[model samples]
Target: MTSHQPPLWRRAVAEMLGTALLVCIVVGSGIAAQQLSPNDVGLQLLQNSTATVLGLTVLILMFGPVSGAHFNPVVSLADWLLGRRSRTGLTLAELGTYVVAQMVGGIGGSVLANAMFEVGTSISAKDRATAGTLLGEVVATAGLVLLIFSLAATRRGILAAPAVGAYIGAAYWFTSSTSFANPAVTVGRIFSDTFAGIAPSSVPGFVLAQLVGAAVGVGLLVLLFPAASRMADDVVVPHPSQKDGS
Candidate 1:
């Protein structure tokens, strides 16, 4: 085996590529479910839920070591705020690259889905509507951030990646928005003309809700585990968890 460290560029690129892959699995699954059986709402939802759970598990297990598999800006921001993610600060350049890569990956996924099913380009109403939908997003996102900080922040939970996937997957059903906790992923879904797509007008509300959820989760985390603030920085990898210490 060889030992070498990935530069910051490689780490950031990994983040971008991992996020894109995650969005594809999530949004792409929804598109497939719709095309296969539009009338079977129950079956479609089940398929969507199953795919999201399985895909997230795979992504996390694969990329969690690579880029922390953040896939969601809120998760990244929360980690940074708590000092869990300090290697690559949330500078304009970093944020620009992350958002752009995520969007590009999302669009690519949507396009692939569209080509497969011959569907038109448009956001799905169920994915962008209010009431249960929006509320679900806020709650799901909050819970997700809360879980990440609580579990993944410490070395004790480094192996809890699978649990994190299951958390989000189950939250999708309980949450009104089917667990669209990630702002980046949310934005990408808008481009897909599938059951998981969000309307443009509804983007703000979802983002706002997700942010709020993150804040709330952070607050509770602080209260429950006051020591987190002191220990958050310990989670970062030296040289991006390089195969060999640089």
Candidate 2:
């Protein structure tokens, strides 16, 4: 391991904490938006999207140095896939660990958000999955994957914080499904019945769509970048001062 690389366990912890805070922001903002703009759905969406945009950017910058700030499973998977070339991002084994950590963090974040809002871990009753939404998921996920991977692969990881946050915020308006691009976020939203929530029944479809979107994204990344070896390190938005010491 390189002297600058943080250990996998530490990275996983960062992922868990970062993801938990991220979901907290997403759900909490949605609840706040709904309350603040009770009569105007458009206003509520604007509020929610703005909060998410700002929150995501801050979170990435805050945690990127620790765990690449990869709170999404698909991103970690993509890292592993692309990392294979130069052995930069994540190794195959690290992929599973990251996914599991992200999932646990996502769910925990949802529950925490619910608790904060007096919802008490309720299952979301908002069954929003539809044919059109699935397509939106594909598009949203594909675009997200493409943007993130492209930046990292091109050694532009520093831009990922604002770039990713901006893309997601934009997707919230441009896409029909409001851009639940991450499967972890999709699953996490199931814990609340608020404006940001999705029904349990919709989980499978959304997850499937996200996976498909990720695949599409990977393909586009390969087509455009064509070289994963160009990545800067073995992680997305690689760590700061930490050294592997191994």
Candidate 3:
């Protein structure tokens, strides 16, 4: 750790807490949307997307300084990959812990949302894993990675809060899968049997698609911003991770 930098334990807590809150917002809002607009699926989506956009932006701003507000496995993985050459972002050991924390947070968040909505914690029956939806995951994840890294590479990481939120909001409307770009979020949804839930059978395909999309995002980053690695430490937000040299 460096001056003004938090310890690894604190960073881990931030990651878990942030991811948990993110999933909470997603699942909670989805449930609310369904109840508020029971007759209009489109209206429900609008409510969900709007809440997500605002909530995500606030979460990023709240946690960015601590852990970069990854809230997603792909984001953390990409950061590790990009920073390996420069030793700026997460190390291999840190990546492992971060991933574990995110997964735990995601599951906890899902359960919390279920409790809040008075819903049972059961496997979702919503079968969304179709060829088209899988393809949508690809598009959504690719765009997310591309956008996040692009902002950092261009030295506009300061805009990450609103920009990332806006992109996700738009993707919710544009993509077929409703833009569950984050693998943690994807898995979390499986625990809820609400409007935001996904069937366990569909998770593998969605996860696979997200991985492919992340690779595509990296490919595009390299092509469009060859020097993107220079900013790998700053994805989503510039944090002490890169500077702590962990």
Candidate 4:
């Protein structure tokens, strides 16, 4: 039996909704963490990361089948680039749609989160600009892409959801920039003034770093998993074959 695949519009809506929710979890949890753990920075981070991990996992599980649960522009672009030769991944038009949806959803999510807490819409005052933080963003994003593609390449696609959530959770603690690996998420973060927010002035550097990291990730994938036997249909979403006991 062939599994029912959603149309482009439905898939696009899923991507937008999924990304919006992801940002909500991130920013909302950060706000909650700050308020709940005012005295201890470590506790705040711990709370924030925990919520993100669980929330991300749920989102992937919920939307992976419909739209691959991308929620991140770099992931979508990388998927397209890697699968261009096979012609089985996202088309150029689909890629554009995904990116735009993600960006818009991210911004909307930030706004929603801020409004929920009655914080009102305000630009982030937190400045994350610095050589070290920039380096951290590069490293964080590179590791994320590498991990994602590597899993897909190695036929470990089923593990993508949990593994990705776990990696991001760990990265939050290890990376200096707290691992804002998604460019869309980074852009959304600028609109919030909470703990997870980044200053508008700092956005460009972080985005550039993430793009550079994506390139590095592709290089690393080439070096490490030169010839994968099969490619997953989507990074986080399992293909029909994986779902129907094929």
Candidate 5:
């Protein structure tokens, strides 16, 4: 039995909406955490990370089947690269579309969150540029990609939502940069001046770090799981053939 994949337009819409909601959760929770825990930076991070963990898990579960729920440019790019040989991954056009949708959705989500909190759109003043933070972004993003594809390689794709969410939550505390790990989300964070915000000047570095990390992750995936497997389009939700003994 073959799975009925949605049209490209429909999948694009799913990516847009999912990415928007993910950023909304990130920016909104940061704003809320600031208001709630004004003095304690530790507490603020705890609250923000908790919210992100839950929000990301839910969003992936909700949209994984539709668009693979990438919500991150690097992840989509990695998928395209890994599946290119087999023609099972995204085409170039689809990759471009997904990246555009994710970036636009991230920006829109930041704006929406700011408007909801009655804080007009403002550029973040928080400069997150430092050697330590840059390295942290690289580590965080690489680990994320490794985790995602590792699960696919092992046919443990069903655990992706929880696994990815849990890893992000943990990376928040371990990594110096709080594990932004996503270029689109990093861009969105530039629009909010709250706890999760990153300065515009710092965006380029973070994005570059993430790209480098993605490359590292892909390398690790190849070295660790050298054998080629049918990587799932949506790691959290298997296709029909995977589900049924076709």
Candidate 6:
């Protein structure tokens, strides 16, 4: 029997649900962090990092089987550019659908956070607009996208799923931005009146930086592993096709 390929609609829906799960975990963790340890700055920050790492690990494992678990737009973009995406990859219509789903899912996470945590009562950070903070956003997001591309997107020979968690977890401390790598998560965090929230004005810069970083990551992958990119283009027929059953 031939293996079945999933329809485009199924992939799009999977993307939507995976993106939503990512946002929900990040935002919900922020709310919980506040409720559990309201006044401890260090603890709150650590909680943010820890929760994000753990949530990502679970989500990656859970949804990877369905849609490759790409909740970040940068990952999708890099995959398209690098040619690891399935078939001819996503058509314009499908790409649009995925983007819309991501945005809507982000908004849904924000709205859920608001309802669950009494949003208006919480105090948002006033320092979100500072130059240092914006710089932090840029660096953090870039690091995340780069990691995704290098780890699993273009270079299939490089590390895969489970290692993605360790890569991100370690980056959180080494990178100045604590690795907020995902745009959807960043957008959702804006609605929460908590430490994790980014100022609305900062979103554009953060996302742009992330895209740049993803491209850079792919470029680096090509530079370091020329054979991989070459392999990316050549169609390798399945080995089992040579079996007597054929």
Best by lDDT: 3
Model 2 scores a C-alpha lDDT of 0.85
lDDT of model 5, residue 176: 98
How many clashes in each structure? 2, 4, 0, 0, 0, 0
Candidate 2, 15-50: lDDT as tens digits: 988888888899999999998889999999999999
Per-residue accuracy of model 3 over 44-71 as CA lDDT, tens digit each = 9999999899999999999999878898
Model 5 Cα lDDT, one tens digit per residue, 1-246? 565767778778888999899999999999999999899999999999999999999988898877777889998898888876766667788889999999999999999999999988899999998999999999999999999888888878788899999999999999999999999999988999888889999999999999999999999989998743357464434543222111
TM-score per candidate: 0.82, 0.94, 0.96, 0.93, 0.94, 0.78
Query: Best candidate, TM-score-wise?
Result: 3
Q: Tens digits of per-residue lDDT for model 4 on 1-246?
A: 565667778778989999999999999999999999999999999999999999999999998888888899998888778876665567788889999999999999999999898887789999997998888888998998898888888878778889999999999989989999889999999999889999999999999999999889988987998753246365756643222211
User: Which is the winner by lDDT between candidate 1 and candidate 4?
Assistant: 4
Q: What is the lDDT of residue 128 in candidate 3?
A: 97
Prediction 1 global C-alpha lDDT: 0.67
Worst 10 residues of 2 by lDDT: 234-243
Off by over 4 Å in 5: 1-3, 239-246
TM-score of 3: 0.96
Task: Name the candidate, 1 or 5, with the larger lDDT value.
Answer: 5
TM-score (C-alpha, index-matched) for candidate 1: 0.82
Report the lDDT of model 2 for residue 187.
84
lDDT for 94 (candidate 5): 83
- In model 5, the worst 10-residue window by lDDT is 237-246
**Lowest summed-lDDT stretch of 10 residues in model 6?**
234-243
Q: State which candidate, 2 or 6, has the greater TM-score.
A: 2
- Candidate-wise lDDT, in order: 0.67, 0.85, 0.89, 0.86, 0.86, 0.59
The C-alpha RMSD in Å for every predicted model, in order, reads 3.9, 2.0, 1.4, 3.3, 3.1, 5.6
